[model samples]
Target: EAKEYAIYIGKMGKVGLMILLVTITSVVCQKSRDWHVGVDTVNPSGTVVHGHANIPLHRGDDGNLNANVHGSRVFGGPYNREQTVGGGLQYEHNSGLHGGLDATNMRGYGTRYSATVGGSRRLGPGTFSIDGGASRLPGSSRTEGNVWATYSVP
Candidate 1:
């Protein structure tokens, strides 16, 4: 019957659309996973083509993970380009303590790596936090840490 045919077609269309969406998303993710993109095209073309994304692929009670990619073309064209791709993972304990590490590599630069460990505790009227870590850049390295306390006034 015509009615039956229409219903079948509708279901097929829905499935096709879903497949297309998922495929596009996966392709985009894969491309960005290895390239970082950036763009600033504010001109007569009215096309500001810039791409930078941070995708959180997993998360659970104990921790979460993310993927980051950044790329940028020349101001008006594609002659000059740059990209950076990396990811980060972090975990938190029930006691309000956490730690994480991040790493990335750029097109022309060497690998950059960093690690951090921090803890936060809630006090009577404020919250206190301490974080310490080190970073290794292309040609140098540095250590950094911070302690912060925050309170709100009524």
Candidate 2:
């Protein structure tokens, strides 16, 4: 009789766990989606703090759009101290098109700027894409650019 009681208790424990999981899943699924924010702090000899956020601009059947912003600060390091802030906008479409523009500035350093554009489409039995970008680094007079094409089939 003790062996039977032990078996019944094990089954009951499993059933209780299953019910808890279902309740948690339902609560999570019913929550609304929104923007995201995050922060990081580390202190190993030196100290560093970073924060970022993602704001949703639009969401539809075609695609989605979002804006991102971030900043970082360093203290008590060999380099003394430094800080940087930047933000960018990104977009996507159902037609296989995407692009983004970004810029950042660092204290005691010049600002850097960059932009990227790319698109992909069906070509015969495969897909073809062309991506290109250009950027000018901080405190640099020369601008760098690159372009490439890719084809893939599966």
Candidate 3:
């Protein structure tokens, strides 16, 4: 029941259209799994035709393809336009302190394909995270980590 689309203007100086078909599914021992699908279209002139949807799925494994966010910014455009896809899995067990590791393949003009792994923990009101990724993009291939703590005087 959700629909969304987008449009853009570039130096292409022409008209083109791209369509998208999306499907979301969950594996829960072959019972009570959820699935949904939709279509989107974009014009050749970097214009969005307007048509998008977000299929709801049950989160049991929490490690699936394209299952991170229910909504996307580029639903009507080509999948190749996406910056990152697949290879990243996340799992958080606790609220006060939780971390997730991720690996993703980068695409597009300045994106390199590489697997990345990073984790972060949140302590009270402060959170710390580290990211080390090797990709085709400039300024995006290094190992880094940080810790931040905040205190409140009541």
Candidate 4:
């Protein structure tokens, strides 16, 4: 019947429209992701060498998530034979928000843990921002925290 054919056509049209919308959304919301690596020698003799790498877990149009690991060693200095290893996760959002959590361990000293969060927003004719962080060292019973704020106009 003509009524049955018209119903089928209407269903097909909706399916096609959904497919087109999905395609457009995929193209517009593409993500950016990459890996980064670096090495640095502080002195000419290369007594201190630091190496680091950053890997992207999720990088999208509105935010980014990354994991980073780093290590440093003193080859031939007063801190010779000393080394440190650290790793952390960093997140940033297009909505003026960011945060990080990290842990580091030194050869002689114990491990240190830290976390930080910050955000910024447009207030009046300028931008207001505030950042706060807390850290704790190994064998310490107390945690230390600090906070800072700023307002800027362009």
Please, what is the whole-model Cα lDDT of each candidate in the order they appear?
0.54, 0.66, 0.35, 0.69
> Candidates sorted by lDDT, descending order?
4, 2, 1, 3
Q: Please give the range of 10 consecutive residues that has the lowest summed lDDT in model 3.
A: 20-29
Model 3 TM-score, all chains together: 0.31
The residue pairs that clash in candidate 3, if any, are 7-48, 15-44, 16-43, 16-44, 16-45, 17-44, 87-103, 112-136
lDDT value, residue 128 of candidate 2: 95
True lDDT of residue 46, candidate 1: 22
Hey, what RMSD does candidate 2 come out at? 14.9
Q: Where is model 1 poorest over a 10-residue stretch in terms of lDDT?
A: 71-80
lDDT of 2 by residue, 17-37 (tens): 334433443454334343232
**TM-score, every prediction:** 0.50, 0.59, 0.31, 0.63
Please give, for residues 1-154, the per-residue lDDT of candidate 3 as tens digits. 1222223323221232222222222321133333333324445422222222222333444432222322222322354244334323344433333333443344443423343444555547766655444433434665454444443432
Clashing pairs in 2: none
Candidate with the greatest lDDT versus the true structure: 4
Off by over 4 Å in 2: 1-44, 120-130, 148-154
